[model samples]
Target chain A: MSPLSLTHRDTVAGPVLLVAGELDFVHAAELRRQVEGLVLHAGQCLVLDLSGVEFCDSTGITALLAARQHALAAEAEIVLAAVPAHLERILTIVGLVQVFTLRATAEDT
Target chain B: MGCARRVPADLNASPGPTTGPGLRSAPGAGDAGAPVGETWRHAPYPVLVADRRGVLTGLNEAARQYLPRAARGDRLRDLAPSWLAEAHHRLAEARSPGGGDVPAGHLGDRFFEAHPTPAGDGRVVWWLIDRTDALQAETALHSARTRSEMLSGIASTLLSTLNVPRCMEVTASLAAQHLAEGAVLIAPPQGRRHQLTYAARGTGAVQVTQQVDTRSVPGLAEALQGFPPVPARWLNPDDIPDWLIPEGFTGPVGSVIVTPLPGHGVPAGALVLLRSGTEKAFTEGEEAFARLFAARAGAALSAARLYAEQSAITATLMRELLPPKLGSVHGVEYAGNYRAATDQERIGGDFYDVHPGSDPSRETLVVLGDVAGKGLDAAVLTGKIRNTLQALLPLADDHQRVLSLLNGALLSSHQTRFATLVLASVRRGDEGVHLRLTSGGHLPPLIIRADGTVEEAPTHGTLVGALPQVRARTIETVLAPGEICLLYTDGITEARGGPLGEELFGEERLRRALAGCAGMPAEAVVEHVQMLAFQWLRSGGHDDMAVVAIGAARSGGPPTVAGAKDGMNL
Candidate 1:
């Protein structure tokens, strides 16, 4: 179980939050807090880069949804970039692919 | 003559004018006439007339009685030595006609205020008024305020922690810091003769628990009788109780205040505060403050004790509710695992039992069940169902009869609660191994064949405990070798999670996962499925899950038990 690491960079669209490692119960809250602390402007898009996430649990999924809700409440947009295959399968199974905008990579965003 | 007159020894007893004929009237003294002089002679307060050079010119009777040796021509500083210097300064200022009265001062133990006025001939008349009672009242009020503040501090500090031992430590340390030098808090003995004691010396607190017969401590037993605080003045070492003295304590304790900590209607413990050095016996005000603090500590201790006791009971009950370890059964590999929802206590409605057959057939009976709800209520129902099934083990050959009987028992005793269960009877013969499975509205058992094919055994029935009678069906199958049958509760298939948490890991996914476990052992099959479902839920927030796997040993030389090869994976 690799420890979760978070990094961020500013872009013209908004800020890109890069998440890596396992996103289970113990580490999900950390990501949630980090995403919630982001300052976004209306019409801006927040990109969540999950290319490095090796595993994700239900708590991690809930955290991502919470980020989407936060973005919606702020009248902004949120996108998932570089989702892994297993996680993408889960997202498709739960029918959340339509809720979040997905991109192949951060460069695409 | 310039000789000063001495005051009479019985001045208070005489109650008469103090003026004597030894003095001659000065020129222009008639301006302040004899009538005014007579008024000054009998005044209640001390009155004195002084010249510019600090010489006393006249004195009143009250002044003579208070000072005992004051007369004309005596320096005013010689009498009332503490206040005369300040009075002289005030008198000089008074001569300017706009100066205010002098501030109050003390003479011996008596407090006094002075009023100086020009006497029309360069002399100043000083009147002294006592203010002892007002000062004492202020001092008392200040002490009371300090005591109440200390009480609030101790209350907040002790009540902040719910941990029993930590609360004791805080109580002792706070008492020492605010109220006394040495503090001791003794909790009532729980079950034994030993009492929990926390003692503080200076700022450091130490726990010194000692078991002592309650009869040995005289005043302590009485203090524990739930009375108001008992104060004791210890004049000597013998005055201290033999049993109450803490080890390594060697200082002179002047007084002890012992108060009962009454909790809810009973006594929780006793708090003992010891004042050392020159501190006097516990005053009324201090005792009241101690009682207030003890009330708060008592309530907190009572609550903490109750919480500790409840936790212990819950732990014991959980241990009993947990499924027993599955023992090795001949000719079959068996493994079982149970995991409750993350938010619930470890005890849940999910339960599994393996009862070996005692009849001629040598069949082993296995039961997996899930009650309708969770928590203690559901756990109790699960226990009843398991016990009833165990009693019906003799009917293992007839699955319908056993389940039908269980349904009747549930309908008669617990009509509101319902359960879903699966019963499996496994036996060995020359042919190979035989299995008769019965499902009481439970998910059908999945059989993973040696050829890596997964099939659901044909078993269906009505849910038990819901109706007067259950129409259960028994399905029979044979495992040649290296085949496993998995029984699980709905917690596996109905687990909700994934992207939007709207997805369920239904029977399709379960069948697919089982297809991969063709030659795997029983324990491995159970572990794989359990892990997969856990990963599907992600947060592990699904309902209680219980799985039991029974696999026929693959035929080679000899068959190996499932957990024997690799220990239980549960």
Candidate 2:
């Protein structure tokens, strides 16, 4: 798996986490740690841009869920942006599609 | 060898035959008043000649620069340094025999060798050769050689063993003997207390565990942490507390050198050298040498610690992660095997167990699962799930209800990880082996019929833990005599290896492989699948693979599906 890289860029709405590379077991925890450090407001929505993700495993999905948990704990909303087809299939299969707010692209919402 | 042969010759040549050992021979009228040659007058060293009355006769340019106050015909006692003057007086008074030893003395921070030659008529000429720089160099060279030897000794001794306590003992004793009169080695704090090893010069090391206050000593806590791990400090002797001083160590403290024993990753420990009041103070060079010793000790100690930790992990995983041995239960043949992604890894996310029922009529519950993630974290979760599932054995009759309870248990836990598992209730019937299989987001079992046809058990469900509930639909199937049904993890189908080592051993390949082993025994079938998967993996990157098989015995049984019971003709 390719090593994961993360970039946090703040937009007018909120911080958009630009996650890249393979989000497998090796790097899933890193994403959670990065999300935990974010400063989110009550009304602002946090976007996880997964456009550059080469792969995602079950642990990667858990990390995404943990990111959601972190955002909700801060009274903020989290959205998965530009979700890949494979990741989209897993999110639906695990019933996370109902739990998370999903968008076609980062600029959609 | 050459020096040994030449020493005696040199000694014989030193004593003059005409001049006795006396300070001067009786005055000879035939000898010149001052018969010294021109070479002696312009010598690089200081030289002087005097009569028995102790008057100067001749001196060289360097001697003129060295003894500016002494003029021609001056008495040697008043001008020359006292050590030289005293030697001259002793030689005169003792008379008649000499040629014993050259007198060495200091001259204004410089050392000199005074060689006295007897001249005619009770006169003596003395030569002074400045040997200050040569002596200093010899001393420095000796110490440097000694320190290097000690460093190599420390390396060989400390690195030979992997035992932590033994390494500490050796380090303490070596420092005490070489660096100072006593030494104390303090290992990094474990929990709260630290393990201390103390040794005094000429004594064996002693080990003691004490709750040491690290902040009491300056630079000690930092050294233990290896923040800037290489500095060696010679702290104030008074600053060394009673706790730091070893038991039975007497005399007032004079010098203390503290050095950090840096390790591969973490700091191994710290070394403290103590010298008594009478002992010489530690030089700057000695302090640096102590740091080098500390490095060797640290590397050995840290290697031992890493080995210990690795073995502990290996043992723990071997016991916790290995699947239970499967065999015939209630006349149904059962077998299961597991392989981790890599040989070095003894444990992973895959886990399975076979629990026998109270009676043959009661189906034995079998479990196989793949926990989310990998490595220690996932294995830990797998263990918790297994324990929880064991606690819910009474509810094994209903797979859907068991899945719901497990999902609830996992959801309440702190970890965000999840798992997918397959549960099969196995029972032997008059017709064949009956199985009620349920899949909770795991792949369903593929049944190998008597006709060598592979069929998937009609079971589908969502993964456990992520959702609030598990909505698995349990499906019933009967394995005819000599028929086998297999439950496996995705690790097999997802493994990538081929001629190019980039192909997946997918579901279709798995079905074809199982179809070939349609009538084989449970053990053979599991091994066959494992063999094919390994061949596909072929040193390629893979995940944890596991397979469990349940087969109906063909002995005295009828073939109920697709035939004439000729499936096992081979």
Question: In terms of TM-score, which candidate is strongest?
Answer: 1
TM-score of 1: 0.63
All predictions: root-mean-square deviation over Cα?
A: 16.0, 13.0
Q: Write the per-residue lDDT of candidate 2 for residues B1-570, one digit (tens) a residue.
A: 000011123332345433223223423212435444455565557778777777777777778777877788888777877778777776666643244455667766677766666654566667676656655776788888988887898889988887889989999988888888889999999899999999988889999998989878777788898866434445666777778887656788877777788989878898888888787887778777888888888898998888888878779767976778787776778888998766787678898988876666667899999998777777888888899999999999899999999999998984577888899998878888789999887878899999999998878777888766668889999989889989998788878787877776878999998889978999999999999999988877778888999889888543243332222121
Pairs that collide in candidate 2 are B21-B98, B27-B121
Candidate 2 runs further than 4 Å off:
A1-109, B1-133, B165-310, B328-330, B358-361, B414-416, B553-570
Look at candidate 1 and tell me the lDDT of residue B318: 77
Give the alpha carbon lDDT tens digit for every residue of A1-109 in model 2. Answer: 4699999999888899999987876788899899989999888889999989976667787798788888887889899999888677657545566678988888744
Most lDDT-accurate candidate: 2
Q: Which docking class does model 2 fall in?
A: incorrect
Task: List TM-scores for all candidates, in order.
Answer: 0.63, 0.56
What is candidate 1's local distance difference test score? Answer: 0.73
Model 2, residue A99: distance off in Å is 9.5
In order, the interface RMSDs are 12.8, 2.8
